[model samples]
Target: MNWIAALPMYNVTPELAAHWRALLAHVGARLEPWLAARGDSLALIEPDEQLERFWLRDDLLLSQTCGYPLVHALSERVRVIATPAFDIDGCAHGNYRSVLVTGAHVDATTLAQCQGLRAAFNDDDSNSGMNLFRAAVAPLALGKPFFSAVLRTGGHLQSLRALAIDRSADVAAIDCVTLAFVRDRLPELADGIREIGVTQSAPGLPFIASKAVPAEVPALLADALDDAVRADPALARRLKLTGFVRRPASDYASILDIERGAIEQGYPVLA
Candidate 1:
């Protein structure tokens, strides 16, 4: 039988790698007991593979994915399992927001002042990294794009580096919950970044399963996630997770709406 597993959206820095492993391990361990009870075992795939490539594959029993790709990219390829509730700034229940961040020394506070500056995004398919930030800048785009150029940093951590270390970008949008973790784990790195604005809250990343997975798996996974948060003190403390909530697909429609609204407004892409 094929194995099933879980993965985060992207890799983390070396310093925080162990913490991520522990969190995923905790979730995987919590899930397996229940999965085994049903004659299904949840395996933890710890490859360095890009998550976006395998998220829709047949063996993708469970994985966390951003809302942007969930709507614009994956669509019906995966079924929603449950949304993780995180205790982070700009997050309530399972809805979370993105932060427009810049180098701590940049004196400009308003988005308009930073016009024509370089902007970096994690990926074109990211909600917090791209779409919402695009919408955030759409009003300022007018007839011209906001940044003189755009850089595809491939990951939020890369975008953070572009702003704080490389100095290649004047601004970037980061997931608030991810920021919370980085700040908690890597305070010195976090100190180099500062938020100027925040995107509207959308549903946080949802755990998804490939259509091939058992239909009853979602309910069991949800129960396991809640149990982990309530019972796994280490994981709960590290992730600041409250619980899991089942948010309808409609909860993510607003993200697509934002994308459409931006496109129709003559700002097809982030300015």
Candidate 2:
């Protein structure tokens, strides 16, 4: 059978996208012979469909998904492979936090001061963008609307633009890795944004494979990731990747706890 793979979560710019493709190709090369021995093959094509649909495919051999969906929508259908540990300020022990950013022009220095202002988030399913932000603001909401309006920007890049360039929104919650990439590769977007606060840390995105794959596949992929980093030190540094660390699904249950905490506080949505 032919399987597929993707590393779509952090491809914030064209340069970053090319790097991720190269990394994926390298891992695929390492896995090819092993998979071929078992009469299986892996494809390095980028998924052309929506991520949720791509994740659900039976032929998905490798992919990266947010912790929010891993706990809420994908726990049973996909098997946890490993979490990539990044060498960045907001990351530690394979866990990462979201940085709350506001435009340079905005005078709100803290989250509390920004109450009732416009807000932007990448997607509701995004742990960094929505869940963490919801958890952070839930206590302040007190069962009432906090932001005057909430915009769904579809991606961190767009959310950043909504906060800095267009000024359509006053603040956004962005993944720390994405912020680092923008600072390195897309500096113009990073220029006028200010990190006002950070959300509680949780396990970063986890690599996942379809449950139908062989039991050995997860460890194989983890080894491939380590090999990929060693083989290309320059690329790994540019990607801010240190190595892959195996983490159980239970480590991600805290993400649900964050959501439940918000809902219990009557702040289910990011409003």
Candidate 3:
């Protein structure tokens, strides 16, 4: 239990959280049979723990983080283990996109129609929530901002709720994987979640280990990820996990380009 592990981003509902626990347990079990050979061990960080606090912990053996944060803030502090390949509707292999969704009552069906409407986003640093959506909106903004205002919901699920349930915002760009999970697991939150537009796909959230770990850890992790998916078909189904990829760090540079592309278009922020 000296090392930490978590898959916090997509656990937007209780069912998904339980699935994540199961996924972790399966991965941990795979490790237990071999980790001792390297004098290493891992354990799930309590699901209820404040996950953001573990981003830089030395004991953080495994975790998933948004691509934006991985490029913008965490590149130096962590090494990517692998990118999970989800079998969700809006994702392909290890890449995912964001959907611009509006209330079913809203007539808008395209990004242009949603112009000047209030936008809800999970966070400024979120890749699928804000950065890619910002990029999608940048070209549409010839010289004026698209959304009249922007709401900063704390996370992807919260952003989905802000538009789908609370009605606090007219629209929001939700992570496709998160949306898929909500649509399937949390029917209440998906009631009016209609997708109007989808952003360009990019590398999905990646599993990252602190750089303090051994140089060989990334390959070890990649192997374990593939093994876990192959060894436990039921667990893979629970999480909609199809497989994983050994994506190079350079593959994530596109996220920075999207952020920079938006800034260059005179619409740096979502608003």
TM-score of every candidate: 0.91, 0.97, 0.93
lDDT string for model 1 (124-195, tens) is 889999998888888888847778889999888888888888788888889988788778766665888777
> Which digits, one per residue and each the tens of the lDDT, describe model 3 over residues 1-271?
3677888888777777888878777777767756787676787866465455577778887889889888877877788889988888667769999988987767888988988888888887889888988889899987577888889988877877777788888888888888888888788789967888789989999998888876776776788788888988988987888999888888999998888888888988777
Q: What is the clash count of model 2?
A: 0
Provide the lDDT at 136 for model 1: 84
Higher TM-score: candidate 1 or 2? 2
lDDT of 2: 0.91
Better of 1 and 3 by TM-score: 3
Record all residue pairs in model 3 with backbone atoms less than 3 Å apart, i.e. clashing. Answer: none
lDDT measured at residue 148 in model 3 versus the true structure, 0 to 100: 85
* Candidate 3 lDDT trough over 10 residues, lowest sum: 45-54
Which of the two, 1 or 2, has more lDDT? 2
In order, what lDDT does every prediction score?
0.78, 0.91, 0.82
